[model samples]
Target: MRLRPHHLLCTQGYSGKGYSEAFVKNMDAVVHRLRTEDKTPIELVFSTDDLCSCCPDMLDTDLCRENEKVKLFDRKTAEYFGLEEKTYIYQKLASYIRRHITPDMLADICHGCSWYPASACREKITGIK
Candidate 1:
């Protein structure tokens, strides 16, 4: 969905709010658990630190008010998994939406997409069974 329009259409993006210390810890634990459970190096990103409301987890039609877990994970845990670090901000993403960058952030965003070995490729390998 994001890729289709992102590559040829729009890709403006932005950040939401700050993260809580507890949520950060929980996210770390969750990432560990998810990878272990999936038997792959997959990380379910939390786009917000403030999970005080279901807003962060739910896809409400309204604008999301959550922190970017992907950005945080890239900074906090990618190296541990032997992955490269990447960052993105709404300001730039917003511009990307407007076709600011040549390739745009859309392609870069998938660079860290954690669903490969976890969900998409789960059946191909015996790791996640």
Candidate 2:
């Protein structure tokens, strides 16, 4: 599964809400697959990814309307996690993130995301060991 870096957090924080019904449905499926298939290989990309494929904001040119903002989020996430554009085992990556992430780090990486403020990501990430 291909995903943008910030999507690592987005997937964890997903709560059945989205820009549109199609986006929500797709997110549910993606999140479900990631949860159920721990061995799934996730390829981190800096560009629009599987989740973005269904996003309403994605234009026909495949760029998001809010591309610059999301790109910054991706960069910050990658920097914070020392992540590279490579494949990782879903379970291992998720575990690594949960084990090392702190609320302060999350706040720094996801500061401007529209979803960050309302999502349970901070609570969920902090709750994990």
Candidate 3:
């Protein structure tokens, strides 16, 4: 599965909501697969990925409407997690995130995301209210 760096965080925080029904359905399937198949190989990229394939914001050119903001999120996530554009086992990556990511770090990494405010991502990832 191809995913953007920040999408690792998104998958963890997913709560059956998205821009559209299609997007939600797709996200649910992807998240389920990752959860059920811990050894699933995920190739992290900086560009549009599997999750973005069905996103409403995705353009025909394969860029998102919020491309710049998305890029910033990706950069921050990669930097904070010491991640690289490479294949990783979903379980290992998820474990690393769960072990190391803090609420303050999540806030910094996801600062401009529109879904951050409304989503329970912080609580889900950091176990903090």
Best by lDDT: 3
**Candidate achieving higher lDDT, 1 or 2:** 2
Clashing pairs in 3: none
CA deviation > 4 Å runs, candidate 3: none
lDDT score, candidate 1, position 78: 31
The global Cα lDDT (0 to 1) of model 2 is: 0.86
**What digit string (tens of lDDT, one per residue) describes model 1 on residues 13-115?**
2111124555446444433343344232212232322232222343443223322544443333332222322233323332333343332232343344444
lDDT per residue for candidate 3 within 32-53, as digits (tens), equals 9988885999998889999999
Residue runs of model 1 more than 4 Å from their true location after superposition: 1-18, 39-62, 66-107, 110-129
Measured with C-alpha atoms, the lDDT of residue 115 in candidate 3 is 87
- Give the top-scoring candidate (TM-score): 3
Q: What is the C-alpha RMSD of each candidate to the true structure, in Å?
A: 16.0, 1.9, 1.0
- Estimated TM-score per prediction? 0.24, 0.93, 0.95
Whichever of 1 and 3 has more lDDT, that candidate is 3
Predicted candidate 2 versus true structure: per-residue lDDT over 89-122, tens digit per residue: 8778888988988888888888888877788888
Error of 1 at 83 (Å): 21
Which residue pairs clash in candidate 2? none
